[model samples]
Target: MELWFTGTNAGMPIADRNVTSIVLRLAETRGEFWMFDCGEATQHRLLRTPLRITRLEKLFVTHLHGDHVFGIPGLLSSRSSLGATAPLQIYGPSGIRELIDSWMGITETHLGYPLSVCENTEGIVFEDGDYSVRCAKLDHRIECYGYRVEEKPRAGALLVDRLERAGIPPGPLYGQLKSGLDVELKDGRIIRSADVRGPAIPGRIVAVLGDTRPCAGAVRLSERADVLVHEATFGGNLADKAELYGHSTAEQAALTAREAGVSRLLLTHFSSRYGAEDIAELVQEARTLHPNTDAAVELTPYAIARARNES
Candidate 1:
């Protein structure tokens, strides 16, 4: 899996960073990608990357802020113009339905594909065989939220060498053994799958939070996550201003990651006031608490590798 940042600024777009929009690309999900927070000009930002509008399967809106949702209509309209026939799903807080309805109804925009809008999004918002997504209400100016995406654990690899050692030639029996079943060979020997399978591969956890201050909801969603994408809207020196604006400073975000026991911290949603040098300094401040912290750059794809330990 990888995270591609389309926009990384806090409230508004600057010359370098745009507002908040992120893409989650999973290798096991065919060519589909899930989007979070489509800010203004998000479609234009996607054009700069290799992500296809047709492959956008779902959108998770964090809040109703203009900086987080102004691009929804444009993105939906452009998807239709680009010939995307696949259905799309959107999940967000209570007023999201009215917001979308007003936009589509006022513009008279007709989409060729079916669009499902899910409002009052919380608890287990989405779940399938492969993954589950849970949302928690966060502390923001409005009713914002944070999402936790967890991948299901996969079966262990079949130990072909051990199977060969047991004189079991490769055949349909291999499939049964891989499925954790006991297979009887032609010689009447019972082969236990447990004896020939490696350890189970643990699933990955990714937490993506919207604009918020340090709160328990953020920690709950980010607890033990492989990657925690939190907003660092200001520098450590601006902690007071950050709290007043319902945003987190870089230092505060890092402390949250540490408290959550997350494996990695990705700080994004930076203020436009910070230049490149200032952003680097903010990252450094975060590193004092969480050594694995990094500033998420726009249009950059951050790969999430599997953890070495199963825990």
Candidate 2:
């Protein structure tokens, strides 16, 4: 899996950064992208990357803030214009459908493909054959939410050496064996797949948080995640200001990562006042507590690796 920062500024746009937005690209699946928060100028940010707008299958909005949702309409329109026919599902806090409907109605824009919106709170919001998404409420100025996406474990590779040792030559039967299907040989011998199959490999887990303060919900959603994408809108020195504004500082985010036992921490939604050097400082502060911490920049992509199992 990989994460691309479409926008990283908080509240407003900056010269080098836009408001909050992220795209989680699943490398195991082809043409699959999950977006978190669609800030203003999000489509423009995609212009700099190789991401296809039509591949955006799921959108998770953290809140109803303008900076987090102003670009949704334009992106939907652009997808239609580009001849995308796949349905788009959006999950967010309450009032999301109203906002989308109002925007489409006011602009008289009609979509060619289906658009579904779910306004929910604190539960499993989405599930498919390969993945599941759960939500939990967070402490913020608005009714914000954090999402936990868990990928289902996949079937393990076939033990080809074991099969070969048993006088089984690689052939079409190999495919069937790998899928756990019993294969009959020309000698009328039955080869059970379980004898040569390996153990299943566990899938990845990613947690994404919107604008919010350090809270229990965030910790729960991010617990034991392979990758935790949390907002760091302020530096360590501004803990009081971050708490006052219902946002988190670098140190606060790091603490959440440590407490939640997340393997990696990605920090974004930076305040406009900080520059590149300041962002480095923020990352360093988080790293002091949580070694696997980094700050995100607009248009930068981060690949999520599986965590090593603890002994």
Q: State which candidate has the highest lDDT.
A: 1
Q: List the residue pairs that clash in candidate 1.
A: none
Error of 2 at 270 (Å): 0.9
In model 2, the runs with Cα more than 4 Å from the true position are 184-190, 307-311
Error of 2 at 117 (Å): 0.7
Cα lDDT tens digits, model 1, 1-311, are: 99999999988999998999999998754788999999999999999898999889999999999999999999999999999999999999989999999999999999989999998456999999888999999999999989999988877899999988888888999999888899887788889989899998988899999999999999999999999999999998898999999999999999999999999999999988999999999999999999999999899899998865863
Error of 2 at 142 (Å): 1.2
In candidate 2, what are the lDDT values of residues 34-131, reduced to their tens digit? 89999999999998998999888889999999999999999999988998899999999899999999999999999989999999878999988888
Which candidate leads the pack in TM-score? 1
Please state the error at residue 218 of candidate 1 in Å: 0.6
lDDT of each model, Cα atoms only? 0.92, 0.90
